[model samples]
Target: MNVEIPYFARHQLSPGGTWISSRQKSLRTFKLADIGEGITECEIIRWAVKEQSAVQSFDPLCEVQSDKASVEITSPYDGVIKQFLVGEGEVAKVGQGLCLIEVAEDDTTHVESTETTGQSPVKTPVQVTHDVAEDTPTEAPPSVNVPLRKHPLDPTNDLSGTATTDHVLATPSVRHFARQHGVDLAAIAPGSGRDGRVEKKDVEAFISKVPVPDEVETASRQQEDVVVDLGRTRHGMWKAMVQSLEIPQFGYSTSLDLTRIHGLLPTLNAHIPAHFLPSASTPSSPRISHMVNPSALYPVPQPPSVPESGRFTKMTYLPFLLKTLAISMMEWPLFRASITPAPAQDTNKPTLTIRPTADLTLALSTPTGLYTPTIPSAQSFSLHALASRVTHLAYLGRQVPCGLTVKDMPRRGGTISVSNVGAIGKGEGASPVLVPGGGVAIVAIGRAKWVWDVSDEFYRPNDDGMEGERRLKIDVSWSVDHRVVEGAELAAFVETWRGWVENPERLIAVAT
Candidate 1:
């Protein structure tokens, strides 16, 4: 009897009389999944896998740039890439097809038509991987043929003869370093780094050992200027700064005495709670009680413990300044207010939305870019807790591609922003700019220095009575939205802040 064979099972008989079943290849389009925080689209920065290349599940596919962060997209299927629907430097919307993958189908039940569902092929939910180009290691590009040249150190001319460094393994940062120094990576082949990877030290060593000829040095100096595109972060800043011009702002400059805080810093550092110390594994130290105390009566409260991200061995004046600012913010409601636009019906009647809690934004400069991460409800936190939070925020900012997320930066930013320019330079004064929605005001704190105060109001006559007392002071400049905050109000607010700063003991009195 003759029987009909299944489509998948149908096979051809070889010359050896052996039946062979053919594996059919089906085309499937891999779509871009939704990356969080209401992001609609992302720019394809770089592709990790090439077209027609085979990839395994969980293999990195491409890196995309969003407004907030850079995320690495990974493949969800084990297949060969058939075609790239979207190229690098192009923006792809969510749910859009990224590439066509060719998957093998062996059984009739598993066979699928060559059609796309227009949905992400990722089996599991998409997750954001913040591995920037610098952090992610990738294979070198194709090598280029170059004319042979002799090296002073290598008499055989084998080590630094040709510029075939395209195959040399190095990170994007190391490559940038080589470019900046005008050194060919191929000349420094067989890098001393692990697994023959080129490192910054390797580039430095190459620069130190390889002496450049006067002719070549002159040619390098006369090289053509190269046009470079601004990164996503810098581009965003450019737009924000442009928009800031529409807002009316006024600048206020003043100096604060920090001698008292400087004197108190050593005591504060020495008395940092054990729980907040980085070396402390446990929350609290063991305490022995001479007499038994009831849970209801004479109850001893446990001290707050610091998270790993917020742990610190020593304290600085910045935290004290932040705490004092929070107190001043609580006292002055206008500083804690955000401007809300008027309703559609009433275009002229805008309102100020005063937040009950004191939210503070800190201007942090990272390798990636400038980020203003907020510390919500700063008034509720004690001095130690405030310091821990600041430490945690800074740690997040320092990470590669930056660890700061939407959580670190909320929709409604801090009503007031602070930038510690003093940490970097010795500038005594600055004219800080204020951007719309950046809060009502922004302050730049400059370096602290000792200055002789001739005013009799602050200092009393010493034993000599001939010279004035020396005071440690720091310069602070404020730029406030003049549309909302009057110049007098800004001065009055600064004076109120000075009260808390001058008498930091009040912070300890009201410690949580």
Candidate 2:
């Protein structure tokens, strides 16, 4: 797992070098490909072939596990594996060399050189120390530079160059922090940790040294640092978060009265028929009611598979929220559109791509990471149908090795996203992130709480008949791309959405 490419081997064929003879030995370096969209790297689970092993094109080379799923990599050439640059149980970055292939040419006579006509020797110097404290200045160690040049196929000399990690050694948390601050890991001074791995403290130190403007000074902090290795999903999230900075976002917050939905849940939940219940004789039978018929208000092109029972046992306000949002997207085409930048050869002006149906992404959080699975053509699904899709997506995301696949996530993706921020805990609202390539807007659903309305005439609501006329409301936070959407339009959209939430009977009346 701790495989490091020898310095001599790595420099034998520099990027600028070329072969002398027509039958000269050629080395083909196989770099890891972008396995999935947005997947920057994957952990090498195991190697199917060893060094010096013969392999034909399309042969299984190794198996890799991304945070999303496990995938097998294949050989691209009919040659022997020269070396495994990345070993088993190590992370391999996209576009980085994974192994070297030695392609032998069919020639009998050829002359080799010693002084270097084809390749140039490279000498690299490395520095090592236990720690480098700001206050402590230690004497520099003696300099030792070695010139390395050797045939990559030769296995004679095992000269070691330096103790270095095959990949950047910072934890996931540190990587996220660095990306957030726009700090390049390669530009930072060598970390004091083992294998010269960068740590959270190093990033904090780097951030502290950055000079702030005199008018806008930041308070200094000396807090303990923590490092976390980001899983596959978290890494994907990190990349999305970094890309989000490019979007100019404008937010709008409004409170929706959930009093009607709160009162309607008990009735809807208790209306389950006997046929919908799982039979004792058929243990595998679906227990939840998946029978959702399309109506004039909400139509379904095709219903998603029936989800397992328990999640649908009780009705919640989420289904109603999804239903209303889908309807709103159908009316407002801008919210269901994405900006496609123009190509270099074309005009500089970008164009917008509008979707015909409302495809909504449900932002669900699990132990693994955040996943937003799109519910395609959401405008067609009844309340129960939408509820079924939400339950299934959440179940899939929580499964071990995550059952969600690339097919489940559309390339164009959903036009709008909804996050149940209230499920985690009580909060006024959250400024949800609209991932760059994800959707045009994202709305956060805050916890529903009881609030007293003081707008009533003095002592008006306190009448015996009108006693306890309090409002039950939830906060709705909207984040829209300013490049595509206007602030005034977002406010109007929220107001329209609030009308649906306040009138629960409208949803039921439209149900088949």
Candidate 3:
């Protein structure tokens, strides 16, 4: 049932009937309002409201801490608070409601005696609804200038008055969030409720609180509106990233031998649990008979299966790929940089301004989802050091809740990406996706399969440490920003990756 609130403000939601209440809607649903100039997301760090607390409109609801700064959102209308949409430490996007309130209806008849005690003219709160004409959505509240002033005090007595900005009349918290977003405190009308305090509720009444009587709001008007499903924070991120297309892109691909990486699986299974296991899994855990008998039956004491992520201690392909990324990046310093659109470059797409550093971005795809966490720019060192870093990042990626099957992590802002399709048993020749955000190049790897030794023991020991000539096709696919790095430079990077993987010992030798 739609819980009828005594009064409701525009854009503010109440217990929205069944579809909402059954889902347990709150009385005052204060969604993320357009806080300050074009800010899309904020981190919800603390709540100013709690269950059953009495509240007035524009009262501070909670602190929405953002990347730039933190601001406490105020309640829009006078009401009693009931619930909140997000938890602490979680992030909320712009326009998403934060809390719920129950507006008390028609309180004009019951003004408290205290409200009448002051000679300061008691202005009645008139509720004006912005009705949508039949088939159109109402525009955001108008930005009218609301007049603010100090109360009339002993006019005849000469008293020393304090001098501060007009915002001094506003609550400290209100001024803080406002200042964090560059909102002019003087522009907001003073609270007529009591003591001229600028409560959170006043902030929500965009037009009513304007200093100038004519309600002419200065906010940009919308021509049309489209909903953002993942919220504007995610949308903003997506938009900001795509803007880098002015930087040119190029790609290169090559075949890679992984037989050596394959050889290490048996040992990995023996020592490591299944959790740490990469995409490929072997049925090595066969049931063995119990040597000791319990009562009348020989109960086999079974342990848990291998950890899904396997173990970090064991040598895996992650280390090898990581080492290659780091070692190769040393020669490509531009890749290691994070500053936007090389300083010397113009807005137009050009090939010359890119850096040479190989700031690596690892793109690992699993049954669960895709993850492309940065390997930090210019992270170059010996192969062993690279191995250490690779293992750490790989383990960290696995722990990311979004990286699992439920949520597919979005990958962006990486110079080079390494996606291991090999884990899913695909051996050789698989093309990975070119993540939209100017992601220049990507490397696809396949499973280490055995190849026949026809050409002078072609399948020699590579990185995974397995001996014996296991014939395997080396599958490596690379995509680049064709403008900056040429076809040959991309080729050279791959050639280096391939060479290191093939002569794993050479990497080890130099690293040592």
Colliding residue pairs in candidate 1: none
lDDT for each residue of candidate 1 in 1-512, tens digit (9 for 90 to 100):
11122322133323332232334456777888655435688778789998889987668889886654676677766678878999987889998999988765442122221223333222211121111122211232354788543322222335433446554666555766798788888888768876577877999987888766799777986796878667656776888899899999899999998888988999988788877878644345335432544455766687675679999888888888888898889989999999998999999999999999889999999887888999999989878888899999898888754667667887689999999999999998998888888999999999889989878766676788756778889999999999999999999999999998888777667855
Cα-based TM-score, every candidate: 0.62, 0.56, 0.43
* Model 1 misplaced stretches (Cα beyond 4 Å): 1-30, 33-68, 71-224, 280-305
- Top-lDDT candidate index: 1
Give RMSD to native, each candidate. 13.6, 16.1, 21.3
Clashes of 1: 0
- What lDDT score goes with residue 238 in model 2? 90
After the best TM-score superposition of candidate 2, give how far the Cα of residue 9 lies from its true spot, in angstroms: 16
Ranked by lDDT, top first: 1, 2, 3
lDDT of 3 by residue, 51-142 (tens): 77887645667876443334556666666776777888677888786765665442222222222353332223333222212321223335
Q: After superposition, how far is residue 354 of candidate 1 from its true place, in Å?
A: 0.8
Q: Model 2: which residue pairs collide?
A: 67-232, 299-380
Model 2 C-alpha lDDT per residue in residues 1-512, reported as the tens digit of each score: 11121212111221233212122245788888765445788778789999989987668889887756666677766678888999887888898889998754422222233234543322222221111122311232354787644321223324254222213455444655788786776656367666666877898898899886554233222244646677656877999999999999999888888888999888877764333333442234254424543355676455333535424565678888999888878889988897887878887788998989988888878756887778888878877666666776777787655667545665667988889999889999799988887788999999989987555422364546554457788999999999888999999888778778888678656643
lDDT of each: 0.76, 0.69, 0.51
Clashes of each: 0, 2, 71
lDDT for model 2, on a 0 to 1 scale? 0.69
